[model samples]
Target chain A: MKRWLLALVLCLSPVFAQHPADSAFSHIYVSIEGGEQYPFGDLIDAVENSFYGGVGFRYAYLENIDGFILFDYSYFKPVPEGVKIYGAHQFSGKLGLDFKWKAIAPLAIGAGFVCDWVRGDYDEDKLDEISFSNDLGGTLTDNETEFGWFARLNLPLIRKETYKVGFNALWKELWTLPKRSETLSVGVYVERRIW
Target chain B: MKSFGKIVKSLVAFCSLASVGAFAAVDAEMEGMEVDQRDDGTFLVGSPTFFYDRILGAGGLHSESEMWSPEKLRQRMLLDRMSILPSWDVMEPSVWIKSGNELGDMIYRDFITAENRPTNRTPILEGGFRTPSFKGFWVTGRAFQDDHFTTSNFSYRKSFVDDEFAIFGENYPMFSTMYAGFGYSANSIDASFLAGEEYIWIFSESSRWIPIHYKPRLEARIDASNIEATVAYEDAEYQDKRKKEKGARKELNGSVYYRCGEACRRGMLQLSAGLAFRAVDDSGMVYTHLEEDRAFLPFVNLRFEPFNNLAMEAMFAVNERDWLVQDSLEFRPPVPRYTGVVVGVKNISGTRLNPLADGEEYFDGDTISLKADGQMNLVQGYTAFSDTMGNVGMGGRVSFWAEHGAETFDVDRYVEDDQMVYRHGDVERINSWIRGVTGELWISAWYREMFSFKALGGFERVDGNSSRFEVTPVEFFTSFTADWLLRKSFRISQSLRYRSDAQWNLRSVDPLVVKGDWYWDATFEQQFPAHGLYLTGTLLHIIGSETIETPNAAENRLRFICTVKKTF
Candidate 1:
């Protein structure tokens, strides 16, 4: 069975293999951006709007699809003032799918997914650990994996050279099930293509 | 702390690779290098970028400063033991794909929120694709990493007929939408089943053709979990205990809706049916019991428009073999067998379906509502947890422009017998009967905005479910909220709640006392135009009271907390 499985995987490899388009693509432009959160009153404040910065390559998949892979790190400090809670710093590698086919270019419909492997360290003194070894709720581990789906339409018609303008309607669901929560965001993004 | 950072970094790298694979192709068009040779292509490696942030003292770690100092300081020390904390980090090399709608693509981004508010400084990198291999069908796929979570999913959606191309298109528009997909977590923490608990689920849903007439949809899901054995020695006694458990659940739901006329857009009717099944196996010290549950529920929604935004929505459900409550009897050798047997294993059943403290019965109830909504082209919303701080939380808000309704349950009969006979082995029969019931009501309403800057307070009163041989209870819950964003970039939020205890029989109990909490955060941001870099800092605090209870007693508590964050 193992041999057969291996053979099958090898045979299917070429079928699912990805291709790099052969065409004359321009640098368009290179850009860097980042932001961060600052909690003033509560110890348990969140890492909302926290600062972040990264640089990446840009390409035109087609006249409609442009993609980029970016590397960035995010830190979430459980700023619950008097209480000490564990904080997490995440390193992420991201890929994006952008669809452009509408009256407005930046406002095209888009859907994509993301995966991240996270290593989290606990300030045991700061965060309380719930031990399932002594009971049934389960044990707290050091790593986290996230998977989710996002559907939205870009309304980035606000820029002349780049179409990263306008408001986007987003419907995304994220869960770490059993112990999971979901988020639904309806917001806008302003994008500019630098050359 | 260093190890944790390493783990997070590696996982991020793995996810980035997975995303890159999910993509069908990467196209880079650079005017200077392209077309040099048709067969040779250049793959430019991009620099690894980093987005950094620090949220010091989040999670209300300082709330109970006196008792929680050790833990609070430990968290701060992870970032260098300063009254203020800092988080340092870096990330993956970039592989930019032309972002667009295609088959098999990916998107990735890293972001940090200051003070952890909904106001996002989120960076998004996404990519994916869709391809039409055959004439009328296509497969669309993509992967992405962002502020909230990471996800990768695919959808095979195809229209039976392109309405625009139909020569004799129906006067009414008709379209079919269907999809089936499976997803797995790239982040272990997000995985459903871990360790002894294992869980994975596959689900699909679809709908077909409808205009103003009738529309229908069906959804289904299944999930499972498990466990194992061990040994222990205590007080010179060695004991061997082996245990295991497996549980699976399935659900199916279908609904249909139709419209009657113009005044009927406000006056439409719909019907829905659903079934849920659950099975369990337990082999643990706490309890060893196997249970099965099956339920079929059917309901309908009817609306009547006597005026403009004023309409009525009546809903009801019919339940069979429904388990309102489940009971089991168990005792140690020390207890009296007769007494234990007499009340041991007493299961109760009734027609009341709704569990709300309000005087509403899902068995037979309807709501009449009046609503007027206008679109100003400006939309906004907020997260429930955002207002509560991390100490406690709840999400999802169903706003009521206003609502009024009446409900009643029918009681055919009820019987009672001697309780002593079962435990003592004395057989005796007694006759008993209960009465049925009917009711009427009316209500006017006014409400406040949820998750908003406005007031958050509400009250409810109940007056029904009282009948011969029937259980009737009334309860109320009132809550208030306050949050403010100050001129100097300071934010403060607080909430308070009070509710009456739940009761089974016609009796009033002391109301549950819930104290409010005041949570605040201060922030500052600066941009370096010369270097194209940005920086920010924040301070946070939480103050409140909470109540805790044990089988023996209950006590209230006072708490205070503080934190800080800096990003560059």
Candidate 2:
């Protein structure tokens, strides 16, 4: 592990030369994306796959890197048959830096922190306090938020003078209670350069 | 080894990153909980308002917060102890929002578990903004409350107060403060005035959590030329619902100091003087009483450096009732070419650690004396050395200290009420001399702009009648810290530390031994320099056992906090 880390650092040192700090936001882009997320590990037992849609703001962070901020929304249905709630509404925000290395041309790999806020959509008139404690999705009636990290691979399929079409595959983990939750998402995006 | 070298460079960056001192976030939040992330000594946070913070080699059994000094004039006085957390010190010109929670809240685990379910976890919330200066004037407001440690003693403390004694939540947090004010700054003058209400729980020597509610605490500060002055007024209310008792205290406290300027600092002798005073008017059962309801402490500081390598420093404070003196002498012998070495000895002799604190505490009907009759004297000798090799630096220090008449409690007995125990005691002292020897070693390595690393370890051997002491300090501690800043934008500051068991001797019948444990804390931050923006997330107490560190206090659970801020 030490040798591998040393090699990676040595390999990246020459390119690690920082760009002009003032050059940030010099080149900006806006994008819209739609994705389908699949629950993994223990999360599979808790929730089913869901589709999400989000928007992103990207800017030049370095000579070979782009910084991006994303905000997305999704609806998840509980897997448990006896769960009281029909579905949960989740809003996620992500911030990351996409590395555009020459060795991985046209494929930018990025990683950053992600936060999710969830609330269960249910009918209050039919709810009972005793049953809520014994039900699977009772806690979702209140606002629940968790933060974690994410990694994504961005593949630009078609490049144009002012617009680009791309595919994104991302993996995220939420630092949830009882255990951690993981998901894999695949999405397509359309980006338009702003500057 | 090479990876660790990048750690120290980032430590330096972490200090600059916060624009404050080295007290940055390893805790979920940084300002008031600096001791949470420290591994250099025994920093036990019994509560936000009460803690036993003493760095190794500091000498004496007295915790650092108990010793009053000129610099701590702005710190809140909780009984005799001083603290800066849940501080109203204000922040730099920035707008920020922060929120966090204890990590054990069951998101889905609540469904399958029927018996012995985990207690509900609490959270913290803070949001404020300080606008940019307009014509040398600015406005600021902040509301922050931490509810992490309120769950363990929730029912026990709820019996003491009516309703939910906090600003926003029913959790009855240790502190909740909301303040708004404005300030003006110029070349020669700077001043500010602020008014707000605050709720705080202070742990007393009698093993009870005393809650104080300040309706409108007003403070004003002005620094002009070489003189700095500050004053505050607090209308505080206290109540005990179970006992059906109520009290109020209207108090005024402030300080004014004329500091030594460049001209005085350039000379062989430097002198500064200050006066700190507090006066109160009490009505009803106030639970505590100041001697004559007033205290005036006039203090002076002197620094004499007659020779190139020798220096002497001392601080003296006295009133009609008591006197305190702290002095130190140091000699820096020019040894090896690029190495620095310091040999010093210091002494502290005082009738009362804090003469301004209330002299008596009223527990039920018992009048517990807060001040001992005799004085305490402590003396210590130490030597420290540091040397740099290329990008690495190493230093070590050894010290031996002894104290006589160390402050302790002679517990008369203990009374249990509703699963809560309270002690009856009067402040006393150990007449016999208690001795301690401490040794510490550290090595630091750094890389330019990218990373910094430091590893330090220390141990102290204290030989004394342990049962009589108030707190037997942690015998040993070790810490490895690292900080990495990628391209001056992304930061990862991490620390892994271990501290030996520290025993509290008199808080209970058989000491409450805080067992040995290791703790890990990390903070990851992303900065947008051109936009003056930062996004930060910190995780604290990742690997330590969630045990109650103090009597009647809550467990120290793992916490995660995220903050977003934009500066002008």
The alpha-carbon RMSD values of the candidates against the true structure, listed in the order shown, are 28.1, 4.9
**Model 1 accuracy (lDDT, Cα):** 0.24
DockQ of candidate 2 against the true complex: 0.28
- Tens digits of per-residue lDDT, candidate 1, B1-568, equal 4474354335323322332101111111111111110111111111001101111111100111111111121111110111111111000111222211111111111112212121111112223333322332333332222211001110011121122211111111111112222222232211111111111111100001111100111122121121111111111111111112222222221222222334435333322222222222212221111122222333333444454323333333344432222122222223332221111111222232221101111111121111111100101111111123222222222111110111111222222222100011111111122211111111111112111221222222223233211112212223233332222122223222222332211111222222222322222222223332222222222121222211011121221111111221
Candidate 2 C-alpha lDDT tens digits along B9-72: 3533443332210122354464768887776888877767777888988888878899888888
Q: Worst 10-residue stretch by lDDT in candidate 2 chain B?
A: B16-25
Q: Estimate the TM-score for candidate 1.
A: 0.26
Residue B176 of candidate 1: its Cα lDDT? Answer: 13
* TM-scores, one per candidate: 0.26, 0.89
lDDT of 1 at B142: 28
Q: Evaluated with TM-score, which candidate comes out highest?
A: 2
Best by DockQ: 2
Indicate the docking level reached by candidate 2: acceptable
Model 2's i-RMS, to one decimal, reads 7.9
**Predicted complexes: DockQ each:** 0.02, 0.28
Off by over 4 Å in 2: A1-26, A36-38, A41-51, A60-65, A75-89, A99-105, A119-143, B1-28, B108-116
